[model samples]
Target: MDHLETWEQKGYVQFPGFLSETETNDLKEWVEQISSWPPDPEKWMHHFEQIGPIARPARTEYIIDFHDGLRRLLTTGKVPETAGSLLGQPVVLYKEKINYKYPGGGGYAAHQDAPAYEFVKLHITCSIAIHDATPENGCLYFAPELHREGLIHLNDQGCIEESKAKSLNWEPIPMKAGDALFFSSYAPHYSPSNQTDQSRRTLYLTYNALAEGDLRESYYADKRQAFADAEKTGDQRMRVSKIGHFNGKPPEQS
Candidate 1:
């Protein structure tokens, strides 16, 4: 589908229906089943309360089980082939997360992905729409060609306000379920408030060169105690393997 060429020219590529009808439905069902309750509903709600009024009752969290499903898709060679063409190597899946924005959910402020990694050029991100994303549904907006400008310092709020003010000149990329949007991690982008009645679901995955250093250390450290607790409970080794996939690296053998 000449994804690399398209992305190179436009700074973003949208492949419609990248997932088949069956595949999309399967993923939706899995999310609904596994996400029936938040990992810590009470604590989650309290955090929102502390933050003041939430635009909507939105849920944000990581799903480890979904990694197997997404990995299967990555290995299928469709998504990875396009990424490899852009990255110039066999890309490694670095992380995955699900963003479910409910009606009236406030939009995320414009920002660059690489800033979180200290602005490394080797980072890339793929955002797969699990449902149709329309303007009203808060589809992503990006500033094309802005990546060439290199890193713009973010303010104390962790946002590049100046760059985002200029980003208004850039275009928004609206996509639908089964469609995927791939862009450089340095690109400036954001989503709008979800004014629609339905939830806006997106599966976001990041890929980086294997030589990009151990990039998932923070993620593993945050969940290290959880892993220890799981081990004590005698969880199946397969479950541990699934958790390890997102842990950045395996623990050292004693």
Candidate 2:
């Protein structure tokens, strides 16, 4: 089946080596630079951690707002074309971020992307592999076509409940450098903890219908304010976005 067909059938599509080797190398260089950026409390670059049954160190994240290469990658690059083809319409960028899951980094909870993006009704995301992602190192697994059901019961963590998630059929998506995975915002997806010693960094670029109007700037502005307010109240964790939530307890191994 063609890409659009795959998207229609799976609620997600994978484009392997969409970028040429040279382009991929260049992007890797850019990732190196971006990853080295110094942390600033005034900026949105941040880290999170977890410990318990799943132990992990801080995972890093930063919004892509002003990077020229990154902007070009999402706008004039293959990301939008791939996403637009799946969407059957022109798509404009909504937001982008890199989840730098280092060794021992905990996994995200199973959650749909739509609920976190309230500024727009429809959104699609493209995840570009910056490094090889293996099941041993936190590659994403998706519940195929469950997105057609829309939002499901959310647990206290603001993610899909454990019981419902257990009922869905999830398939793992392992990727090599330069591979891209596109999925609807409603798709239920999650990644496992990075058990390997290496890092697994993926750049997630989200877009909405061009007709929805570009809300990227305002969206980040609002997030900055929201997080800033949350910081002031000593309750930041509760207000943090659900992008990386771990849906429920890990299933017991028999």
Candidate 3:
């Protein structure tokens, strides 16, 4: 089946070598530049986690807001083309982030992203592998043909119920550095901890149909408020988002 057919049938699709080798190399360099930036309140937001004995950067959000290379990459390219095609309409970016799953970093629990994402009824995420993602290094695993069911078995933590999640047979998605995986927000998915010594970094760009209105700025505003409210309540969870799916601990000094 073609990619559209695959997306229609399974609510997801993978495009091998979606980014050319040269493009991928360039992206890797851009990621390095972003990674080296120190924590600054006025710029891109960074989050850290306790990975083994070290406090390593776990995630970076709103990257395209500050990085010209990534902004151009998403705003004008095959990335938006594929996203618009899959969404069945012209699309606008809803949000974006880089998940840096360093060795022993963390894993997200089984969950449907639709619950966490708001301001749009339809959304799809494109995950571009910046480094090879292997099962040994925390590749994503997705439950096939389940997006049609809408949200299901969600827990208080905004994730799939533990027992229910464990019951579904998840298919592993191993990707080479430049591969891209696109999945609906309703798809149930999870990833395991990176056991390998190397890091597994993936850039996730989420988009909604342009007809739904451009809600990127509003989405980020809501997220910032949600996190701040959580902090005020003394919710010291080491989660990357308002959702409690992350399985990592906060750095001791946070």
Candidate 4:
């Protein structure tokens, strides 16, 4: 079976070493560059959280306005095309982020991406491994076949409830530095906290069908405003379920 079939059946397809080492290295360099880029509240939003007793930073909702390398990587570099093929339609960019889960960073609770992202009709995210992912360093764990049921039972925090998640068989997916994992928005998945000293960074690019009309600008605009609103009202919790996993402390260190 081809990738399209695999995606349709398994909810995702893991393309290990899909990117060359050189390409992966290039992306790492971009991660460094973007990390250093002043986190201006107006342009992009980043999060700094406490991991155990240490504070670590990660960037999300970063705009691709002036970043030539990332622009090429997302558009001309075949990410959108690959996602389009898997989706059985031509797709457009929806959202992008570099999840640099630093050491001691907390793990995400079991959840599906669809319910959290309701603005769009369809969503598919491509996770490109910027560093080797292992169970020890918080690699992704996916629940196969649950995506077919659509969105599952959600908890107060918007994550899949433990009662519901317990019924599904979970599997840890490990990838090399240059691999990519493409999963549907409804796919049930989560990750553990990074135990190793090294950080677990992944570049995630989400896309929607071409017919959906480009909503990238609108999406980010809404997020920026919502974030400001959250701050003003002190709804300071990570409203987005994706990053909400990085809450207070990483499970009380000994």
Predicted candidate 3 versus true structure: per-residue lDDT over 124-185, tens digit per residue: 99999999999999999999999999998989999999999989989999999999999999
lDDT at 215, model 1: 51
For every candidate structure, what is the RMSD over all alpha carbons to the true structure, in angstroms?
Answer: 9.8, 5.0, 1.1, 3.0
Cα displacement (angstroms), candidate 1, residue 173, comes to 1.3
List the global CA lDDT of all models.
0.61, 0.76, 0.90, 0.80
TM-score of 4: 0.92
Model 2 regions lying over 4 Å from their true place: 41-44, 48-65, 236-254
In terms of lDDT, the best-performing candidate is 3
Per-model TM-score on C-alpha atoms: 0.73, 0.88, 0.98, 0.92
What residue pairs clash in candidate 3, if any at all? none
User: Which candidate do you rate higher for TM-score, 3 or 4?
Assistant: 3
10 residues in a row with least lDDT, candidate 2: 244-253
Model 3 lDDT vs. the true structure?
0.90
State model 1's lDDT: 0.61
Q: How far is candidate 2 from the true structure (C-alpha RMSD, Å)?
A: 5.0
Return whichever of 1 and 4 wins on lDDT: 4
Task: Please report, as a residue range, the 10-residue window in candidate 3 with the lowest summed lDDT.
Answer: 230-239
Which residue runs does candidate 3 get wrong by more than 4 Å?
none
Number of the predicted model whose TM-score against the real structure is largest: 3
lDDT of 4 by residue, 202-251 (tens): 88899998888888888787777777777688664664433354443422
**What is the Cα-based lDDT of residue 123 in candidate 4?**
77
